[model samples]
Target: MAGQGSGGNVIAAICNIFFPGLGQLVQGRILAALIFAILFFGGAALWFLIVPAIIAGIVYIWAIIDAAKYKGP
Candidate 1:
């Protein structure tokens, strides 16, 4: 994928808006994708606790930013 600020990053960010970690998957970041997916989903699963729901929201936003700002090595 292209470096940060590229079209790919924009698309990735948009993808992440729909589902956490999807952007990373699109970028071929399997590990990051798995981690984000797990963290977000896990937190979301505990929504009844409130705190976990907040954490999930944070994770979701972070995933979008991470994907958008990712600079390929």
Candidate 2:
């Protein structure tokens, strides 16, 4: 249903906003989620700025799109 799709999109957006890979985790994409989390957080640590946030924003949009496209569990 559209509602379910939207809900997933919201969750994905939230996850991507707070931390990369979170959306994937919610989607049961454990490996991908972990990879994204490490890469994003690691980059933040190395850069010492908001670069990760910017990257996360992009990823968040991607996640939302993916969530909207989700067809099943």
Candidate 3:
């Protein structure tokens, strides 16, 4: 059971890796998905600035880690 659960987490993490918030959507976290997508894309749009790039990277990494650990509220 532990392995199975971890497998699911790995899958979700992979999904989020490709696209921010995708794992949240897959996990049925609609609000989180929307929020993450918005923050991710918004930050990405500001990529011309070095700060936004760093911020976006941070948010993107957070999204991935969050999606992996999310257990539904």
Candidate 4:
């Protein structure tokens, strides 16, 4: 709410740590939340494959960083 590095962003980042895209949802970014959730969870669901698992891990980290650095539009 107060741009990147704000307390809200920190909290959002922490939320994303627990659940990918949850931070976006908390920030009222429905589309972003859906996109990240789908990407991360979908990839996670296919974790039997090495590539998908790696992709999901990357997505999970990216989601945290995205939430932390997001500046509201």
Candidate 5:
């Protein structure tokens, strides 16, 4: 069930690697995409601080994993 070929979810996750919410947008999860986009870009905007940068990195990675693992209609 998981890790089945290069399916849409896989593609989504790959897209997320480049931009945190891109995968969600591709998957048609508009709200989730918006949240991810806001957090990612908001944090990125304040990435001058070390803490914000680290947090943004963590959120980015989480978004990637979430996109890869999401299972739903």
Candidate 6:
């Protein structure tokens, strides 16, 4: 269980890193994913600073938590 959760978290983190909210989508959090995607991408387009990257990192952490708690397909 721990391994599975950790793996899911890693995947979610990676997905979120590449495409914000993608990890949430994978975990069945479609609305949240869409929102994050819009905000993340929009921010990236508007501001190319370290802030977006930091936000991505924070989202990735959230993804890890979500992944750890996920129990569905």
Go through the candidates in order and give the clash count of each.
Answer: 0, 0, 0, 0, 0, 0
Model 5 residue 10 lDDT? 92
User: How well is each residue in 34-63 modelled by candidate 5, as lDDT tens digits?
Assistant: 888888888888988878778888889988
lDDT of candidate 3? 0.80
Better of 1 and 2 by TM-score: 1
Q: Please provide TM-scores, in order, for all candidate models, with all chains considered together.
A: 0.96, 0.59, 0.83, 0.96, 0.85, 0.57
Q: What is candidate 3's lDDT per residue for 40-66, written digit by digit as tens? A: 888899899878778888889998898
The residue-by-residue lDDT of candidate 6 on 1-73, one tens digit each, is 2445567656875777666788778666798788777766665564568787677656556654655566654
Superposed Cα deviation of residue 25, candidate 3 (Å) = 0.3
Better of 4 and 6 by lDDT: 4
Compared with the true structure, the alpha-carbon lDDT of candidate 6 equals 0.66
Model 6 TM-score (2 dp): 0.57
Instruction: Output the worst ten-in-a-row residue range by lDDT, candidate 5.
Output: 1-10
Those runs of model 1 whose alpha carbons end farther than 4 Å from true positions after fitting are none
Give lDDT tens digits, candidate 4, residues 1-73: 9999999999999999999999999999999999999999999999999898899999999999999999999
Clashing pairs in 5: none
lDDT tens digits by residue: candidate 1, 1-73: 7699999999999999999999999999999999999999999999999999999999999999999999998
Q: Rate the local accuracy (lDDT) of all candidates.
A: 0.96, 0.65, 0.80, 0.95, 0.84, 0.66
Q: TM-score of predicted model 5?
A: 0.85
Task: Tell me the lDDT of model 3 at 20.
Answer: 92
* Best candidate according to TM-score: 4
**What TM-score number comes out for model 3?**
0.83
Off by over 4 Å in 6: 1-4, 48-73
Better of 1 and 2 by lDDT: 1
| Candidate 4 ranges beyond 4 A from true positions | none
